[model samples]
Target chain A: MVHQYKLNGYHIVLDTCSGSVHAVDEVAYDIIGLYEEKTEEEITAQILEKYRGREDVTREEIRLCLADVAKLKQQGKLFTPDTYAPLANEFKERSGNVVKALCLHVAHTCNLNCAYCFASQGKYHGERALMSFETGKRALDFLIEHSGSRTNLEVDFFGGEPLMNWEVVKQLVLYARSVEKEHRKNFRFTLTTNGMLIDDDVIDFANREMSNVVLSLDGRKEVHDRLRVDYAGNGSFDRIVPKFQKLVAARGGKNYYMRGTFTHQNPDFTRDIDEMLRLGFTELSMEPVVCAPADPAALTQEDLTVVLKEYELLAQKMLDAKREGKEFTFYHYMIDLTKGPCIYKRISGCGSGTEYMAVTPWGDLYPCHQFVGEEKYKLGDIWNGISNHGAQEEFCACNAYTRKECEDCWAKLYCSGGCAANAYHAAGSVSGIYAAGCELFKKRMECAVMLQVADALPRQE
Target chain B: MKRIQTLETKNLCESAKKGGCGECQTSCQSACKTSCGIANQKCEKKDER
Candidate 1:
C-alpha cells in the first residue's frame, strides 16, 4: 500500500504504516533510479525485492506503512486559524495582513430570487439599502487602520450579485486607492461575482488590478437556473456561462477561482464537478448549500448520509486525478493538503473569530464568514472598531479542545473550534459548539472515507 | 540529509493510531465514506486526544 516515487530528483516516500510522507532525501529517489531500473513492473518488483524477507521491517511495520500511505495519500488536514496564521503573515509581507475582506452581499437587491436567498426571502430586513460609498469608506478605514502591521491590503467586492451596484464597487476601489495613499498603505484587490454582468469593462478591471477573481457558477444549466436565477423564474446558466467563458479566456485561465454550492435537488453532482473541471479552473470549492429549515434540510441524519455519500465519490475522482498528476485542486480538499499533518496539535483550525473578519456593508462586523449577522456571534462593529465587550474573552474562553469533555472526543484537535454560528444556532450557546460540530463533521468524514475505500476495494459481485 | 532530518524531526510522521474511530462501532466508517480519509483519521485522533 505504501508507494515511493521520485519527482524532479526528490525521493518521495509515502510510508502508510508510519502515517507519514517523508521525502527521505531529495537524492534517495535518485539513488533508487540510478541503482534500480525504471518500469512499473520493475519498480513494483524492486520495492517487493528490497522489503521482502527483510526481518527488520516486521509485518506490523508493513501494515502501518500501508495504512499510512493510504491515509496520507488520500486525505490532507483540516485547517485551523492558528495554522493559517503564518500564511497570513507571509501574505501580509507579500501582500498585507488584511489582504481581502469578502463582503458576500454588498447590496440587498437581487434580480433573481432563489427560495433560500437571505435578501430575497428576508427582504433585506434591517440591511442597508445598498453598500453606500460611505459604508464602504468606513469598512476601508477599519481595514487600513488595522492593517498598519501589514504591507498591502486587499479588498474583495462581493454581493447578492454585486453587479447590482457595480458602479459603487468601481467607485469604492478608486476611493480605497486614495485612502491607501492618504493612509500610506499598499492596497490590492479582487472580486467575487456572479458572471451575469462580467462585461468587457469588469473583465478588464479584474484582469489588470485584481489579484484573484472568483465567480459563482452552480453546476449544469438546469440545476443552476433553478436555484440561482432572476425573480422571473428564468435560468441564468446559459447567459452567465458565455460571459464566464469570455472572462476566463480574457485572463487566459489564470488568477481565478470558481465556487459553487450544491443542494439536494441536484443528484448528478459528479457531472456538475466534471463540467467545472472542464471549464479550466485550477482552483474550485463546492459547498453543499446550508439548506432551509425543513425536515430534510436541517443536517438531518439522512441528509448528512446522502451528502456524505456524494462527497466521497467526488473526492475519489479528485484523488485519482491528483495521483495521476493533475494540476487542479478542490479548495476544501486542498485545505487538508495545505494544512499538512500535525495541524491537530497546534491551534491550526478554521479562521473563525481570529485572523479573518467579515464586515457587512453597513459597518457591522462578524468574526468570520460563516455566521455573518447572528447577533450573538457578532465580534465587533466597523464604525466603532472591534467591540470592546467580553466578546473576545467569551470567544477565547470557549476553546473546546482544552475542555475535558472534548479531550476524549475523536475529532477535538482537527475540529479546533467548530462554527461559532452553528454553535449558537444549534445548541443555543457556544459552550460546546466546537465539540458537537467536531463530532458531527467527524462522522461525515469517516463515512466519506469508508464509502470511498469500500468502493475501491474488490467487490463481491 | 536535509530531507531525512526534516522527516525525523517532524512528529507528523508518527503513525500511532491512538483512539481512532476504527475502534468505535458507531463511527462514520460504520455507515458511510468521507471525502478525505486521512483527514478523518486525523480528526478522529485529534478528538480522541
Candidate 2:
C-alpha cells in the first residue's frame, strides 16, 4: 500500500511492504482545493487580483503558479499565505556567510579512558598534548580576520580534557579579552570539561575570564564510573563532584552548568536531577548516549528507559525548583526564547561545518567534538584551513528537519546531526550527525519543556 | 520455510539444517533477529492500545 506524507510543501510516498515502510517523493499533486474547495477559476481570479498592476504576470507566470498549486494540492500539502510568505522573507534575511560558534580543541591528551572513545577508533591513539602558544595565536588570528565586523563570536574550549591544557587556555582567554578590546567584537568563552579538573584555579579562571563552564557527569557514581574511568578502572564521579562543589561554592548560584551524558546503562537516571540540584548546580544539560557496537558503555534496554525517565524527571524537578523559590535556568529554554522565528535555519545543534568548527592537535579542522578522529570527514587542516568551499555550501543549505516525519522529534533542533565523529565513524559520513542527535535531544527537551511550561502556568482551580 | 529475523541476529549461533526449521541457540539472536529487538519491543509497547 502507498501512503502519502506531506512534509513542508513537498509530498513523499511511503510504500509499505510486508509491514515495513519505505518513503519516496516523486509525483506532484494538484492544488485546486489546497486552501479549501476553491474552483480553478476562483483561484485564478485570486492570483490575478494579487498580481494586479504587474505587467510581468504573463501566461507563463500564471502557468507556473497553477503548476505549483496543483503539485501542492495533490500532495495534500498546503502552506497558508501568511506562513509561507514570511518564511521566504526570512530565508533572504539570514546572513549566509557568518560562523556563529567556534570550537577550539585546545588539547589532544585526555585524563581518563572513556570506553567509547572515538579517539581510539581504527588505529588512532591518545597522547598527552596541548595546543601550543603559536597555534593558539594562529587560531585567534584566523577568527579575527574572518569574522565580520558585526558578528558575535563564541569561542568554546573542548578536550581530551580542556583543563588538561590550562596553560594555553589561560593564554587564549587573555587573547580573547584583547581581541574584544581591539575589534570591539562580542566575544564569549566557554569550556567543556570532565569535572575532575574543576578546582579553585579553574573556577577562578572561568569566573574571571570565560563566561560559562560545562562539566560532564554521567548521572551517579556507578554509571559514570563504568564509562568514564581512569587507567586503573577507578570511577570519576566521587572525585569530580567535589570539584563541582568548589565551583558552586565559588560561583554560588551565579551561572555555572553541570552537563551529563546518560548512556543506555544508567537506569532510572532521572533520580539524579534532585541530587544535582542538591549539589548546588543551577544549570543542567543532559544528552542521551548513542551506542555503537564498539562503544564501551553499551547498556541494556532498561538503561535507555532510565535515561529518558531521568530527563522527564528533570523537567518536573525544574518545576519543583521554581516552586521552592530556587532560581535556575536550562540552556535549552533560553534557546527557544532568544532564538527568533528562523530557529529552523539554525543548525539543529552544534558542529564545525555548521555554526562551529573544531581543530584537533594535528591542526585538522573537523566539524566539532563528535568527529574528533575520523580523517575522511576532516573539513580542513589547521595549517592550511578549510579548503572545500562547496562542502560548506551544501552544509549550510540543509534545513532543520521539521516535516511531518521530523516534527515532534525531540532532538529536532538540538541534536545538530549527532556527533560528527559518530557520523564519520559509524556511517562514514558527516552530513547529519547533528540531525541524529537533534531527534533524540528534541524528544528529551519536549517532555522537559512541556512539564516546565505546565508548571509555569497559572493553575485553574 | 521458517522466519529468520534480521540476518545479523541469527548469523552466529542459530543452526538450520538443510531440510528443517531451527531454534536460536544464543541470547544475542533474541535481541538482533527481528526489526532490531529493541525497536520491536518499543513497537510492541506502542501497539498495546
The top-ranked prediction according to DockQ is 1
At residue A306, give the lDDT of candidate 2. 58
Q: Write the per-residue lDDT of candidate 2 for residues A141-251, one digit (tens) a residue.
A: 666655654345677787678888888889887877776767767676777778767767888888776666777776666667887888787888889988877876777
> Each model's TM-score, in the order given?
0.64, 0.65
Best by lDDT: 1
Relative to the real complex, the DockQ score for model 2 comes to: 0.01
Candidate 1 lDDT, tens digit per residue, A1-461? 13354332334443322233445432333323433245434444555556677554444543443444334334431110122323222322332223133343466556656655534432344553567878887787777776544445556565556777787788878887777776766665667777777899998877876666777787777777877877677878888887877887889655676777666666446667788877665566565555344723234455556655666566667656756787565544432322234432222223334434666667677655445556766777777766744664444444434345444444443444455545554565654453333544654444333333333333222
Q: Which stretches of candidate 2 lie over 4 Å from their true place?
A: A1-96, A118-128, A294-296, A299-302, A327-351, A401-428, A431-439, B1-49
Deviating ranges (above 4 Å) for candidate 1? A1-105, A118-124, A152-154, A179-188, A279-282, A292-300, A322-327, A335-354, A376-380, A398-406, A409-415, A434-461, B1-49
Model 2's CAPRI class is incorrect
Error at A328, model 2, angstroms: 4.6
